[model samples]
Target: MLNAIEMILICLVAQAALTDLALRKIPNVLILSGLLLALILHLLSGQPGAPLSQWLAGGCAGFFLFLPLYLLRGMAAGDVKLMAMVGAFVGPWQAVQIAALSAQLGGAMALWMWWRYSSKVSVGIPYGVAIALGTVGVVAWRHH
Candidate 1:
């Protein structure tokens, strides 16, 4: 049962990573799909309406977790929402940790991208890839 969500999340994370790497953006459809999936799964599990606290925590974690990077122009707003969706399914604290790790990975990758393309184009790497990858790492670590 839980594996189902895990699979879905893993797949989506992979897609997000690819999109971020290729297009430099995490599409709205992908993030929306994740939220919809969690809602549908929550309903199917007979939990109809998940506790408001959980959703609130998830949203809060997702937003504030990425705020610093956003302020620093290190990431995008879309990535923040994406992480929130992940939090909506996983919870707050874990989501924060995942975001933190992902940000670290993203930061390192961004630096590399910057250096690699220093003379080509002035742009930042799509950090959604890092978030998705980081989330996967946290999930696997949590389960193990």
Candidate 2:
């Protein structure tokens, strides 16, 4: 059985992935709503396994994990914020795992796109898809 936070995290990430893939952007509304809901859930639910400090650390870790890529113009601001919101839900260590997995998934996607596109046109990937998928993987792993 999934906890409330876990379910919300899945829904939020799924929504982000859908929006990102279709529109090529992850909306601020989704990220902010996810963060706000996570904080509220933490405050009200008294969830086990992680305290508020750990949640904050997770958010920070998630933000910093992708900050370098964003700074290098290799990623979008929405992707960074999306990961931070995911961190707020999953906590620090899991967030690290998710970020690492997300990077691998994103790289695979890039390679696939490169191979699929024989033309030399530049194409930007919506990394939120990778982040969402990675988050789902981590959450599913925790469940089993």
Candidate 3:
């Protein structure tokens, strides 16, 4: 059985993936709600160590890591927010891993799409799919 955190992460990633694929936009409501829920979960977990503190650190890590890409126009603000929400679930180090893995998946998908649809005028990538897959991959790897 999946725990609360895993279920929440899966839901967040799935919702983001669907909206991003369909509309090319990640909604603020989804991201903000995910963030709030993650913080609440962390606070409620009440582990020996400060889970909320770790979550905050993770959120910062995710925000800063993707901020550069957003500033450079390589990524969107919604994507950055989505990642920060993810970081709020995982810790800083795991968020870094998720980001790295997602980037690689996104890059590969872009390359494949470009190659396969060279004639298309626009081959925009749905990056949230990559993030979702990456999150799944990391979770599986960690739990294994």
Estimated TM-score for each candidate: 0.84, 0.94, 0.93
Tens-place lDDT digits, model 2, residues 54-91: 56888999999999999999999999999999999888
TM-score preference between candidates 1 and 2, better one: 2
Which rank order by TM-score, best down to worst? 2, 3, 1
For model 2, the superposed segments whose C-alpha errors exceed 4 Å read 47-51
Q: Which regions in candidate 1 have their CA more than 4 angstroms from the true location?
A: 47-51, 118-120
Indicate which candidate wins on lDDT. 2
| Residue 13 Cα positional deviation in candidate 1, in Å, after optimal superposition | 1.7
Error of 1 at 64 (Å): 2.4
Per-residue lDDT of 9-73 in model 3, one digit per residue for the tens? 98889999999999998999999998888888888898756465668888898888889989998
Q: Which run of 10 residues does model 1 get worst, by summed lDDT?
A: 47-56
Cα displacement (angstroms), candidate 1, residue 30, comes to 1.5
Lowest summed lDDT across 10 adjacent residues in model 2 is found at: 46-55
